[model samples]
Target chain A: MQKGGELVERTETRLNPGYGRWTPFWFLAPAVFALLVIGIYPTISALVTSFRRYNITRPRDGFPFIGFENYINVLSDQTFWQSLGLTARFYVTVLPFQLFFGICIALLLHRPGLGMLRALARISLVVPLATTYAVVGLIGRLIFNRDFGVANQFLNAIGIGGMDWLGSPTGAFIAIAVMDIWQWTPFCALIFLAGLSMVPVEIEEAARLETSSKTALLRYVQLPYLLPGLTAMLILRSADILKLFDMVFVMTRGGPGAATDLVSIYIQRVGFRVFDMGMASAQAILLLIMTIVLSRLYIRLIYKEIE
Target chain B: MSTTLRRVLHGAGLIAVLCFTLFPFYWMVSSSFKDQSDLLASPPVWFFTPTFANYADIFADEKVFGSIVNSLIVATLTTALSVLLGAPAAYALARFEFRGKSDLWFWFISNRMISPIVLALPVYLLAVQLKMLDTYLVLVLIYLTFNLPIVVWICTDQFRSIPIELEQAARLDGADQFTIFRKIYVPLGLPGIAVSAIFSFIFSWNELLYALVLTRRSVQTAPVMATSFMSGYELPWGKIMATGTVIVLPVTIFALLVSRHMVRGLTMGATK
Candidate 1:
């Protein structure tokens, strides 16, 4: 056994240092190849496609390279700007509430003496995270159904009349945002819970000794320690929310007068619904640029905090 | 605040959180079993004889079952392929030193930051050109854009946690590098691998955008099928709820099974 093992090792190393040197490349090649095909190739294709008019409906037009025409058309489109504004609004509205409630619930669940309650909280938290976005949108539609929906029922029970959710512009937007908060707040909470767990007990104790006030303890000690976690949550959530498509698609289809037409929805509509691949590619490139830029800003801010 | 008052408030808060997190799910499951009339009953029917007619209705639809099969095939294949391709690269990054290693690692992880919309159009066009649209192979491949980064990131962390001393000791004992990796590191890093597998599975399973945009009638996944119930007038709430429950049930069960490792997987390279 020993001799056989030695032979294997000798053959692998002494006989083949060049093979040893290239092993990592071999391991990495499959993944790099896959990414090149799926990730990089598509990105490059998107860049090129953006410059050409390749309408599926008008294939005979011959996908000619139109230079900046697609970009100009996309930029000049009012709906594109509207969708951009809605996307921004959706992000701004949903993120703070997710963070606020997420942190609150995290703090609540993180409290030291709540054994069973904490377990229950943790289990329930995973349910939302486990749910698919499209399903969440379906559930949102059910609850917000104006005629006999549970939401309207609750409102009516409280003497506030039922309001049109998917039928009106503002209500549709708010409905989508609310649905997002419901689906994702638990994710934020769990992330914060993980972060809270990492906060050293000694630091908390030291802060408690310095101040008897809970708010001060939170403001001074817990929040600072949890900043990294908060930053991670923000980055993950913002990136996701910016590209959120499935929920809005299932719920409203960017309807009720395009009130909920997020940038992703707009792009899909242009590409698939309207068969405007060139314009959609141009818009998609812009969305990609926006995501990268925003994420970079976030990384810069967080790294500055860390330093 | 007094201790008793604080305790009461905490109790109330926990209950509220539970309801907030769980009510919609409960509603979905319950509505699945409710008759069409009970589904839309005013003030919501708190008590009723639960019926499985909606479940039967969805199951009877051949298209729904086909989509479910499609989802299982695509998600399972994507998960398996991602882990297979990703684990080695992760091991290499964790164990080997080479030029441009950090840059390469950053590039791999940053792939997660790319928006799916950016890939969607080009991929669709490519699929059209290649005549691979509505095929499981295309989806399994496209899903790599999301799943590969996750597998690499998590498994890299997992492989790193295994002490170098263990591998060196195995090497001194005349074990080849591949043998050491296969016999020692893999077993030792099984927990991380499990985390990566569970995450990749759940993500590919939950993914809707690619499945929706890429596939039409023959290859539609369960999520896409569920969305179809929305378009027609007089929506079938019962069937929709039933289908929603079907999509969520397996994932929720799997998530609970691996809930312990979830935070670690999700907060990869962030907190640590």
Candidate 2:
């Protein structure tokens, strides 16, 4: 038995190095345990809770199992559908503007001759990225205040003033979009700048020589290199927008007649304010399924790149 | 176009972008210092005499100071716990090729992608069951769901960049796996660790959804305190801005300190 154990240890050492068969396992055990407790446990519990009739207000009912009823209710609710639509609209509204301005700013910053100004601009970008989301919402409220907001002041400067930004549905939606774009465009720019940096210097110079047109060089040379980082940005940014709650929660509270009622806020209102756990958990599970699909695609792409 | 004209246009574009990005922060900080009259001016006072009155008001409110302390404690503990638990696991994944390693990596990274709203309800339920609601421990544990993944994701990349030959050399010197990691990997991977630590600190500091749900009064974070002002009938723009600026200052400083790693940290090492 001792000889066999020694032989097994030797083979394991050959496979790795100077480590026992269980060393990696021991090293990984703490994090795995933490993930199970902190990450997986709640998800599993949520899945279970989604199928029950659990409402905090109705404590005497005792959360009896009522499989599929909660899911059916959530699917059939008009507000749920409307909230999902608004979430999608919110994503659509901010993403393109962010991408366009982000790429444009990245191109400018990446230009070689800018020198000190480029460094300063990059530093400025970090400020927005660093600001807290809730604070951004507070800033949004101050910026879009009809009577005293800088936004109105600027609009007045350019001949379009006195817009009641957060008071009207259309205005509230646009205000949220503007705030989101302001906060995240810098993030997109930084990511695209990283992508641009990945483009080979030789390829860029050679492509420039072949076609003096900036568009041609960017289309043929830089776009391919940017695609992976762009994909990463899309996956992350999409996930964030899907779960966007804090800024809107603080700024509008899905207000002005639910004009900016993103799905998360809708769910929060149901789950916390209304104390409808089963319905909220069902909605959460559906959102979780969408996130799973998106993340799977992201994982597949990342693995392909790594391999 | 002439080269000079192109250069001039490029400079102008950069300046415009800078103004767009920094303008909010300027408004936030300047507004925090403005008295109500200046703050409520229709045209919005661009230049004015700064007042300490807003700062004084918020400072006098004990909740603001308490929340800031709570935020500091929760964020610091969360960062400490994530690094302590994540760095070793990262070292293992980076050094040893084991079965299910890729699966484990996928699981950890996917935790970040899971919307907090999904977890908030169940986590809240669990916290209530355990009688852990409104506690710092619950907040730290809930934060780990995201922050731990960040630590693992970034530190794995950091540990991977350390030369394998160094590990071999350490082993030959009679160092065990723990010793090698402790002596060689830890020192070599400090920058990555620092970046991850910064990311963890910033995220934990700024987190709102879970903090809002999980803690009520005892451990409400700075962001929650900042938002609590909104519940009043009349909005106090100056006091709110003061709270917002105080909450944002630490993170902005941290962000600038590691500006070089911003891209790498933000993308979770995908770009780097």
Candidate 3:
């Protein structure tokens, strides 16, 4: 038994210095260290803060821990409920249009013999991404203005009256959705183009040369190749749209009447504007949970076939 | 005729998209030239007499030039820190074999997944605790949380794409790991680094939320400066548009110049 123990120890020592070494930790420490302090710790702290009533105004009194009361209030609050509905509306309106426009443009540019047009299209698509969201909001603001704006000018040119896009609830929601589609369609298109470029040309050519069945080619040949990338882009875009804040904050501040308030925008107003840290933390925790849950579910549903 | 129909439709689609994208930017520049009353006209003005009063106001009242300088410094610092931190990390990942590697990688990227607004409150508290609010370091750290991952991700892609035999050949010549990276990999990967740096700086410069939450009037950046009038009693569309133009012009030019590289960098690994 003693000889067996000695042999085991000797084997472990030799192996540790060789194949299954501790080297990855050295490469990983700085990134993991920063992320822990900045990303992970803050999230855990936010979760803990949600259970306590923390008002900076009364720092002298200090925080009083009240377990789950904040969560109860947040879940039951009418304004919180409205923001939830508004966020859903945003996701519904913007995501489909984003996917459609993105896929359309990706397919359009996936052809041959349109060099200059394709180049111009590619550059134009990504310019919005380079612009800051606040500036983007303002750009959308100037264009969507009901009066003395280009949208109205175009409406007049088409023999139609311009509606107040940011002045009413439905109109404001539409305006915010429009802003989202404008900002992110390029991102979607780019991802799809990346995926499109990777599609096997011989398979496509085989379909074109050997068979003239467009539907069969699309339904089988192309879709399967593009599914993984489309899944990734969709999950990312969905999560991002749910957390949309900067543009809405700059454009409407949850606007004409809480119409454009996304989940993050709701948290920002509650936390920053009203100075209700407890309630805000509750909202933040909720949004965080919803985002994680939805993203995981989406990834699971879309990628299940691969697994 | 079928092909002709396709060409005309494609042409129209191209025009529509260009108009959709550039019209807003054009109006921003055009609106800066319009007078206050002209801006408020019932229908929007397509062609108008141009002026530079709005631009004059931004430079004069808001001290737009100073904010631009502030923006430049913060962005440069943030980009530099991310690259400095990220390059070493990327090198470690590309060359080493270690434990919990993938988990560590995914953890680094959780910053990108988790919303910044989630960290806004705690980061605000951490900044005050460290007495680092409104300092360049604060901006660097906050931007680093998100930007470092990008650098690591982009650089890792670039590093991995380089053939391993070259590194082996250098090693056989008695070159150490650090020397090999510096002498060979760094020069080869310089363009990728440039792309990554530009992107990090652009993201850092264009960020408004953290700057809005952390900084005050004295150390305010461009994005925060642009928001000055929205809180005022009266709206100043012309002056606002002027600031808007100034903020976007640099990024617009930068984006067009680096479009090809940006495409490659952003779409990294997605195709593969």
Candidate 4:
């Protein structure tokens, strides 16, 4: 008892509202330091590099500050506009399919009962999410192979003869879309499931009593709950789709004569392959602006506030 | 609709989703284990005597095997660094009312919106200037920056959910701030940390664009090895599949283990 009292006395003296004003800064300093060095610094450097003629091959001609020349070149180039349009098309193509199927599957999984099956289904969803993007491209290549692909085998079973999946412009575009949809649709479903879970049991039961039609009930009751998550998904997806590379790079490499050349791949070609650093940086900076602006638009228009 | 009919439809829907998600995985693993002829068979041989030759071939190749090691080192270190740096900042954000708090939060979260291509060239040049290209340190540092936002975002959510009374009690017991964080918040907040770690690991492991541009022969990652196959005239399906399976297996297992918290993690803790 004497020892405990002594310890309490020492503790009381020590507990003098110990935390100071700079405590949070001390905690945050390391991360903030690292971000400043690696994240913000590089971004500023990229912004600077975008305005100059910084081609690696032409070092004799020093990187002079040629304001807007690189931007003008990127903006005026027909190939850049085509690639940009294709990127937009890719986003438009995949979003609807993913959202539609995602919600449908989430609704199915959201149903009460089927305990074991529901658990198993959720586990299976992680496979696609976990698959490396490059591997997803390779998987696309193997599956879409004309001669020996499982895709053709299945199509043959269904009595549709195989066309060149990665050869023709239309086919390659579709193949990339299919791969993206396969990879991301599960993400949509998972997010929607989280949203659906928020629909209170009492509310769901009452709604079920009011209408036997699942569609009617979902339209009236659940979709409002889903809107926030749906908006989140849209913003994230828009950002991702705009910057997509790895998988398409592995699968097609902007292939069969620039058929599947999304903007990122094109920028990479200009930057690394063509060694035009300034032009590539300009294109990249523009792409970055587009992504930020698009997400901001989503937040302002669809997602007013998220708590 | 009858109860039985509704049940059957639900089962059908479940089957469709499973097939769409898992069929490619089955194909990849099955093809990886098949002999060359069976792998290239037209009616894509459903049944075959599995062989370890493809796996053996990949393991025997020095470059292929080396990249697997490189991926492991980079990803593991990146995960460790992200959690170590990000957790404390997250605790601060969760607990303290400080100046520029909202602005700081937005700044960190907005990092995710920056397209990698925007920074790719500049990062490549920075590495060149620093003479750090083709090294694991560069990759780890860059990945840490990318993964930090994820860790901070999730852990902040996790830390916020913990009761403030716990911290008050700890303080009453004379525990210091660091002690409260390390002892109380860290343990209670572990689920969030693990989820973020798993995500960080998977992302770094799977990352390609930065890995491709930054690392050359010496520190090339597993994804780079997988993509190098595309340059060859003859596509080796069996070996390619084996390499992919090896690369993806660990992270897939990690992801499945934490499926419960995945929704919260993926959505940056916006839901659940």
Give stretches of model 1 more than 4 Å off: A1-19, A297-307
Q: In candidate 1, how many Å is residue B185 off?
A: 1.8
Note the DockQ of each predicted structure: 0.62, 0.81, 0.46, 0.66
Query: Against the true structure, whose TM-score is highest?
Result: 2
Query: With candidate 4 superimposed using the best TM-score fit, by how many Å does residue B164's alpha carbon deviate from the native?
Result: 1.4
lDDT of 1 by residue, A126-189 (tens): 8988898899999999898888678888888899888999999998988998899998898788
The 10-residue segment of model 4 chain B with minimum total lDDT is B263-272
Per-residue lDDT tens digits of candidate 2, residues B183-265?
Answer: 99999999989889999999999999999999998889999999999876668889999999999999999999988888777
List of clashing residue pairs for candidate 1: none
Comparison by lDDT, 1 against 2, better one: 2
Candidate 1 lDDT over B1-272, as tens digits, reads: 79999898998999999999999899899999999888878768878999999989989999999999999999999999998999989998888867788767766766767778889899998898899999999999999988888899888888998977577667668887678778987899888887788888898888888988899999899999999887767788899999999999999988998787676566455665
lDDT of each: 0.85, 0.90, 0.76, 0.88
- The candidate with the higher TM-score, 1 or 3, is 1
Model 3, residue A162: distance off in Å is: 2.1
Q: What is the TM-score of chain A alone in each candidate?
A: 0.89, 0.93, 0.87, 0.91
Regions more than 4 Å wrong, model 4: A1-18, A295-307
Docking class of 1: medium
For B41-78, candidate 4 gives per-residue lDDT tens digits of 88788998989999999999999999999999999999
As for candidate 2, its clashing pairs are none
RMSD of each: 4.0, 3.6, 5.4, 4.0
| lDDT (C-alpha) at residue B88 in model 1 | 87
Worst 10 residues of 3 chain B by lDDT: B263-272
Ordered list by TM-score, greatest first: 2, 4, 1, 3
Identify the CAPRI category of the predicted complex in candidate 3.
Answer: acceptable
